[model samples]
Target chain A: MARWEPDAQARLQNAALELVARQGFERTTAAEIAEAVGLNRRTFFRHFPDKRDVFFAGQDQIEADLVAGVTGAPPGESPMGLVGLALARAADTFAHLPREQARARQAIIDAEPALLERERQKFAVLARSVGDAMRERGVADLEATLAAESGVLVFKTAFTQWLADGESRSLPLIIAETMAALRALYVTR
Target chain B: MARWEPDAQARLQNAALELVARQGFERTTAAEIAEAVGLNRRTFFRHFPDKRDVFFAGQDQIEADLVAGVTGAPPGESPMGLVGLALARAADTFAHLPREQARARQAIIDAEPALLERERQKFAVLARSVGDAMRERGVADLEATLAAESGVLVFKTAFTQWLADGESRSLPLIIAETMAALRALYVTR
Candidate 1:
């Protein structure tokens, strides 16, 4: 076997999600997932630190994109506007994922307490990163934190809508609409 | 020993916080906490499901109070207004706790990953409860969720300020100010 296989990470992730969704996260093992994809457990460990991490493969890239979005936002954008750009960047990532795969991954996460906790921690870290990025743009400390959290809240809302059964809207459209709704909450009578 | 002792829960909570703060969350056992307060481990379990539960003793009451605040809010109140009332109700609960104990409990939670996960879970549940309460008040589902999450965000920001060194504002006051700040983000230029 070649030392490096093409798209090993994606293959492993698909296998892991399929197996875990079918047999349940607790019942599935890392070795079993790797074997399903014709890779050894050592290779699996090389891609992900643990079984839980397989479910969150693109987390680092998502965080980096969010930070870059904030850092490279157009000048004179409000804190909330910077968050909007960051969320759009995240939407781009989610848009590339097949809806069925994303739905299956969400189901696995929703059913497992450990996975849910990891998701929460990931969101917390992402919010902190976004907040720090806002600070670099000269947004006040408290405002940065507020904007970051609100952005995550909007992302969560928009993502849920996108994942809803029979919901046909694009992720970016849902994000823009959700952001508008959030702003409307304060602006309208 | 009497089957029921007055203030047993409060005493156990105090002991648990002191022990957990001094020795750390993982090292402090339910048995040690009970013994410190002159109670048995069984009695401790009666009040709390586990050691982790000690740090979240009033969670149920806080949930109930928030729901009650939302349900009993004035007619014609906006969803966000109801969230404000619920947050104020929660602030009232925090105001009664000794600041020193609150600070110590926070320190313990901050240092422990398990506790932080539990804290995140608690907040998630609290947000759900608040959202349901809004539903009962005829708020739309999406708006209810957004308001509930945004309210929790304000509580978190205000709570952090309340716990900051040398800061002395009451929780309710801080909560109000944080809410204002959140509104300002969407309203101001």
Candidate 2:
């Protein structure tokens, strides 16, 4: 086997998801996933600590993007404005992923309570990180937490809509629309 | 021992928390917890399915209270208004719990990742139930979800405040103040 495999991480993630979706998460093995991608089990273990980690492959990158979005916002923007920019940026990460692949991933997560728990934990961490970023930019503590959580709520709502059957809008567009709807809720009456 | 012991559930819960806080959640056993409160392992199992459940003893009642608060709102209340009422009612449940006990429970939850994951899952369930109750009250689908999520965020924020060392406000007051802060985020400028 070649010592250097290009895009090995991506290949392993794709293979893991495909195998898990077909055979179920518990039934799938790391070795089988590696073999399907023409890599050894060692290579799979090197890329991911466990099979479940493969299911959440790009979460760190997504979190970094969100934090950068908040930190880089123009001075004088409201806390919610910073959150809006951050979530829109994070939505772009989803834009690069194939909707069918994302849907399949969601299906696997939905079927497994353990995976769903991990997903919830991931969002909790994301909210905390985004809130910290907002605080670094001088937003008040309570406001930062509220904005970060609200941003996550918008992302979740828009992600669901983006994955809906026959929906044609881009993820970023859906995120923007969701943010607008959230604002509308508070402003009306 | 008598098969029916009065307040066995609450006794077991208090004993479990004390044991777990002293010995750590991983080191504590259901039998040990039951023994601390003058009960047997069999009696503990009857009250809770697992030892971890003791920390979350009254969650079902809390969920029911939140849902009822949403469903029982006066006619023509807005979605956010309904959420505000629901969370404030949920706050009352926390008010009945002694501050030190709630603080200890939170410490244990914060120390254990498994417990924290379960807590997040509980909140997720609470949010969904709150949203469903809003839907039954004629709120639109997206608005209902958004409002429910926002309510949970307010609850979490107020909860942390209520637990803070120097803060003495009631949970319901903190929840209402948090809801007002959430609204202020959108209404200002």
Candidate 3:
């Protein structure tokens, strides 16, 4: 792999997002994305299996980090606590992206039904991964699944609020607050 | 539509499931589904736009029923209570299907990535609808969203446990118990 492979992949993704935003996802081509990044189609294909995958390129790494986070957490913590920490760490992975790029990508996903389906599947996969990681910690089946799924809900709700127009909270802060709020819901009754 | 329209649609769906289970989803054609049901191709198209829709045809009605349940609940009910009741009512919509048919359809979906993606999207949509219905009842946004999402987790968890081998608990009982369990998770901490 080239020393600059990561940068090249990011560039290809950014270019693809720009092209997909200008023209609909259906009209965008892999060659065009590569050309915009000053790379060849073969180079693009090396980084991404297809144009659709370019947007979801970091999913594998993110999923691994989430699972590792849960599995590596101190064993004394509760299941939901472990899941929460794992998802918070995963949120940290996205701190590197510029807001404009994030918004641009989200726009394309919001506009395309196919991309929305892919996004939902990504979240589902993350929930399953977190559940399995919980089981690896000796948690029971139902508890692990429920805690993992609830953690995912917190992650999604926080991400939505963090990205909303004019909202300025950091992802971790938002996630923590959302988790507290979710817990508080049951307490008030 | 004719008096037999509902019966025809149900037959087509049953036939589609049988064929999809036998030869796989990609290999099963619309004509074959119609032939299995002893119906014409035109009748198939009238009910479902494509082969994929045959499996998802009930989603529209189910979603509508869920939303209505939330909206029409007693004003004094908690958001989670309303959501739980709504989901239970929706389960009744599927109570008429034979257990074997439900198992066969679920097995196909579990084995196919595409069908799994569709299922996740369906769950997401239901969560959104329940949340919106909560909003309509004067509930705050974040609370409504969280409650709806948590309710979906309960619904899913109950459905999984209910459908497991040798399990025969009624859907309402299972849903009620799952919601209690979820709330209990927050209490003991």
Candidate 4:
């Protein structure tokens, strides 16, 4: 019942992640990835402009879900509270991925400087999306931006913790802990 | 006595900023920057790797100062306090530059995507430097990194506010305010 061919894209992405994890993003070529998936290079390019593209393809969907989550928070929550809710939702979305798969993905990204830069850019884009969503609900500009950036910070902190060794904690719990840490900074000030 | 040949590097950097501000980072060439500095292109290349290098010449010095500040904080001060002190000091170091020159430098960077990427890389380097300094001080790794990253966030937020229209506040005050906001995030949680 899906509108698009989800399995095909998933296969290509998983193959790219696997090859990149083994050989490194810089060393892994699109041709090898396509061949691994039993698809031609042209079909690979149809799904992604490059290997980096595969890493970023999920971002649009993530942003849409984030916006919806922020906008639909319970009736009386503060702006910051709404942002917290959105981040919790995002953490939950990623929670079902196997730990080994997530670790491999993070390792692939950490090994590539270009991929890290692109990740930063993607975070910036997500921040702007959060800002736009907050503004739509009548929050002003600078505060919206500040809240969005703060949300991304919290999300990054939790994600990093979740990806680390001995981290049996859930992403949502880590996110709540990070929010507490950020709040502690305010209190100490 | 000053340690190095100051005028040559300063003149070259100023010329590059001026040209990039008047024209654009992409449109301005190394030859043009050299000519503006009253030097030949070869002399320009002697001091900087390329045109982009001119914008980031003193980051090493700033990072050194930040590490020193972090390592020397009094016992019992949170890592965040030490980092805030370093950021405030760095902002003050730039305070002597004419406001127009500061704006011009930022304007050139704002106009170039490549320059912005370089700036982000520089910040990441600075963050790692601070984190490493904290690690050397016996702070645990993840906490050290979080504190270091939080410092960079405060610096960035303060810098953006300092550059905003009608913002007559001092850099330290702005940084302190940002720290306060960051702390508030944790408190209200």
Candidate 5:
């Protein structure tokens, strides 16, 4: 029961995640989230437009990191390698989340249809951003788009495994293994 | 303008798609959709909860076909082969629409955020269904899910290409080429 003022947004999101886990998304509301975090209704609105916004606040940072990672890869790296680096960067971003927190968030997302759809749009936005970033770096056409999309797909699989395995292993290792698996899936053909 | 009713559900969906294409989804109303199809608004509501449901009417059928194809693949067919067959069935379903109608439908979906999210959910559902079907047929854990997801990914690539190309070439051939490319992407590793 520590009173923290500057971390309101984070506190709100945490509260929302907790309620979503305990009572399910449909039963949770903005007022409940605000009360859970010891904040009033107006303060919650100032931080997030709605309850869904609380779940999505981190997406912008993730997208920015991905773009930065791809753009800042070693000069000689291929498109695939650059994309792989971006995935590694994302793994790093999620490394600090406690395993229970990660699982709770994921379970909430998995159970809610609208949230799942919003999650997909976020991924699609990231993929398109990656594609655009690739094009800026001289990769062209559908090839760039597909490479970016493929990287996101691999990252998703890797993250799923990493989270499900109790977060004992690092995300980068899981991403590497996922990339290797993708290579094998196609290479065997 | 021919008027023939097969099922109330089909008529409502067709009306919705047609109206959305002509007037845009943002402007179309359920009442107008009912008027266009010679059905009462109540009948339309009975079949679909909202306007978005019309474009997705065929989705359940597509997923059913995917499940059937994945589960019914012959004993010797590999996971990739089973994926290929399931996608071919999807292409067959898409092929039934007139090119203009297909393009019109896609255009509407591409322009709407809600519709775009719904479209992603549909693909996710199909992927999950395909994975379940594959699992039922003895495919293992992560591998089955990956194969199912990869199949949807390639199918999406092929469909985007086909729509952009105005559906001149064979859908199956385009899908096969995309699948081959995806396979090569990993195989080269």
Candidate 6:
């Protein structure tokens, strides 16, 4: 009898990120990743096109959720307010994944130049998509663009810290804190 | 008699970026870049260890100018306000570069993934140094990090639009406008 785990994709992703973190990303092989998780090479390929995709598996859903958060925010908030609320929702969604898993993914990304580039490209894509989503919310051009870029940067900074060792704050809370610190800029002006 | 152009470094940088833009960045070699500028390989190596460094020619000066802008700001300004002013000054310093040259530099950076990563790394370095400079100015930990990161994102977004074809706004003007839009988040709160 075959004992199948329902979360095959996640298990593979965790194994791959861990393997890449333990060894240099360049030295890790697909077969090795599959072997680490007791999955066949074919099954691994079915889940991920390549090793890098393992780390960014939920990318599309993340963008969609982020966009939905922006476009579907409660009315009457300022553009940046709506964007901040949107980012908070986005952080909550990410909070589901274990912090250690995120850190494992980040460790590989931080160590490899090529993976770092891929992460940069993902952020660039996120900014463009988030900007467009805000535009769909009827926000002005420059306003939407600025808020989108700021939200992504805040998310980036907070997410990095949220996964730090001994850290226990929720992603949304960290993001709110970061945004509040930023807002202090205008009050003191 | 050889005619000497004093700005060989600038000429080399221009040649390298253009070459990378025209040909794919990976296909362009250092020898080709030197040949394009009529310099010997040894001369090229003297200026930059490799091809990637050419796109980041102003690395040291940009960091110094940005840090100086933060450290030397007139007292009685909010940390974020000081950062905005410092970013404005940094924008001014960059504005001295010809628009056409900056556009050419950006074109290759935009087109190549590897160059984009190198650019990202440069910005990360800029943010860290800017944060340290703010720390030295007596700003709080989270506040300094957020401001520095925000300053870089603002710079990135403005610099991108500043060099767009048919656009003629000064870098500082674009930066100022971007900051104003961001500051509205606090003002309207």
Best by DockQ: 2
Question: Per-residue alpha-carbon lDDT of model 2 for B37-71, expressed as tens digits?
Answer: 78899989988887778888778888898898988
Chain B TM, every candidate: 0.95, 0.94, 0.89, 0.90, 0.88, 0.89
Instruction: Evaluate all candidate structures by whole-model CA lDDT and list the values in order.
Output: 0.88, 0.87, 0.82, 0.78, 0.80, 0.81
User: What TM-score against the true chain A does chain A of each candidate get?
Assistant: 0.95, 0.94, 0.91, 0.91, 0.90, 0.87
Q: Candidate 6: fnat, from 0 to 1? A: 0.63
Q: Can you tell me which runs of candidate 3 are displaced by over 4 Å?
A: A1-6, B1-4, B92-97
Scanning candidate 5 chain A in windows of ten residues, the lowest lDDT window is A180-189
The alpha-carbon lDDT assigned to residue A93 of candidate 3 equals 86
Model 5: how far residue A94 lies from native, Å: 2.1
- Candidate 5 — what's its lDDT? 0.80
Error of 1 at A175 (Å): 0.6
Error of 4 at B89 (Å): 1.7
Q: Of the candidates numbered 2 and 3, which has the greater lDDT value?
A: 2
Better candidate number, 2 or 4, judged by lDDT: 2
Q: Taking the true A–B contacts (Cα pairs closer than 8 Å), what share appears in each candidate?
A: 0.61, 0.71, 0.49, 0.22, 0.31, 0.63
TM-score of chain B of 5: 0.88
| Winner by lDDT | 1
Q: Runs in model 6 with CA error above 4 Å?
A: A1-6, A74-77, B1-6, B75-77
* Model 3 Cα lDDT, one tens digit per residue, B1-189: 354765888889889898998999889889889887678888789988766778887788778878878987888787767777788777787666466667788888888887888778888898899899899888889989999898778877887887788878776677777777777777666
lDDT for each residue of candidate 5 in A66-167, tens digit (9 for 90 to 100): 888899897866777777878878778876757777777888888998788778988999999998998888876566777788888887787788778445
The sequence of per-residue lDDT tens digits that candidate 4 reaches over residues A1-189 is: 333555768888899898887788888888888889777788788988766887777777668767877888877666688788788778777767687777887888888888888878888789889989888878666557777887887787788888899999987788888877765554665
- Model 4, position A145, has a per-residue lDDT of 71
| Accuracy of chain B in candidate 2 (TM-score) | 0.94
Candidate 2 residue spans exceeding 4 A from truth: none
Worst 10 residues of 5 chain B by lDDT: B1-10
TM-score of 4: 0.88
